[model samples]
Target: MKASDQTLPLQNGETLDILFRSHPRARRLKLRYDSVRRAAVVTLPPGVSEKSGLDFARRNSDWLQEQQKAFAGQEFLSPDNFISFLGHDHLILHQPDDAGRVRREDGRIIVGGPAGGFEVRLLNWLKKQARIRLEQAVEEKTGLLGVTCHKIRIGDPGSRWGSCSSRKTLSFSWRLIMTPATVFDYVVAHEVAHLREMNHSPAFWREVDRLVDHATISRRWLRQHGPQLMALQICGKSPAD
Candidate 1:
């Protein structure tokens, strides 16, 4: 079946994939499911046909569903929500000041009112710190796992805690900062194992297990409270911040 022959109509709970062709700038594809819009988005590289794109989605159906479930449980942060940083609970504050800082003075991340808003700016700062901390942790743990990574970056990713690309770049969600240190370490180890083995094979599990003695607890924490962390608004930043 060729891509030009037919266009597939997406049904409820059914997945539809698309491929868009354009300029030769880069080989890239982006995935997002618009629940309100009621469709899955697949932005492909230039010169790609719709059929090949659909086939790609078919090939990755299981992965796509896993991503969708991850998205479903995510909670976007609101202003009234309280966020715990370091040790104390700070009500998300929205203020106007020359500087945006997420700091502890008298044991609270004072927001707005000369401090700053509690959303985008604060999230950006947290992402910056989380990347530094996570990359350090990844380097230390991967040494034990006996693997090297090309690069590491932290992002406001919606689907998963972390992902390892074929090129060896390790991308992690900045939301990991909300969790305890142990949980963060486990995620770092999990991604590093991908360097040794791309698939979730037994060898991969063994590598992760070797680095983090208690992996299941961290995994469970994300399964249960991960969405809650997603819902937190710090420094008036968006969830992706």
Candidate 2:
């Protein structure tokens, strides 16, 4: 546990991790679950006491545990299980063959490989797909913004869909490929805009809007469902039985 983090005891007897964040412009105490950190975040407005924040978290410990339970109950990546691909639910199907490639067929994701490596293969394929899409989007956006990206990387990041480094490298969550094309494109535009404006000032937001359409709708969708994307896990096989 970091020195800045605290622990809260849940009604279910689990010790929930709490990360306190102090924001200068925060209007009130807010609590949220951090899917990547597997902890609860308590945002403290400028004048709030740490003790008061802890008490607030205690008051909502049940809500925090509910989030933990929801993610814990998330199923693995296996046959017959549904997964979102390009903003659509696709059933996972296992093909009995070694070294067969993963492919989409008739709106389903077909995995052709040993059952033991099914999850690994499927995840790798998804990463590849994410990289391909991000690379294409980045190339297009950078050109429009008259900027150059140092590198492009795809991975599972906590609480952020995309980031642009000072070095000009761009990082994105592979799970974004599962979201709608507009959502994915908006994230790409967001990071690309950062290549020119490093802060979230009005200028940066203007650049984001200049790059993509339906910016408001995309932002709203992510705020509501980003956690659901992070909650995805490849647990023990739920292969077709």
- Which segments of candidate 2 are over 4 A away from where they belong? 8-15, 20-32, 42-70, 236-241
Q: What TM-scores do the predictions have?
A: 0.63, 0.80
For model 2, residues 1-241, the per-residue Cα lDDT tens digits are 1235579988888898888888776778988787757788888989998788899999988778877877676666678888898899999899967366999878899989777777877888888899999999999999998999999988876556888888999999888888999999999999999999987789999999899988899999986677667677765632110
Q: CA lDDT, every prediction?
A: 0.64, 0.83
List model 1 lDDT by residue over 14-76, tens digit each: 544443434354366544443322235555667775666666666666655654555555444
**Winning model by lDDT:** 2
Q: Distance from true position, residue 32, model 1, in Å?
A: 11
Weakest ten-residue segment in model 2 by summed lDDT: 232-241
lDDT of 1: 0.64
* lDDT (C-alpha) at residue 86 in model 1: 31
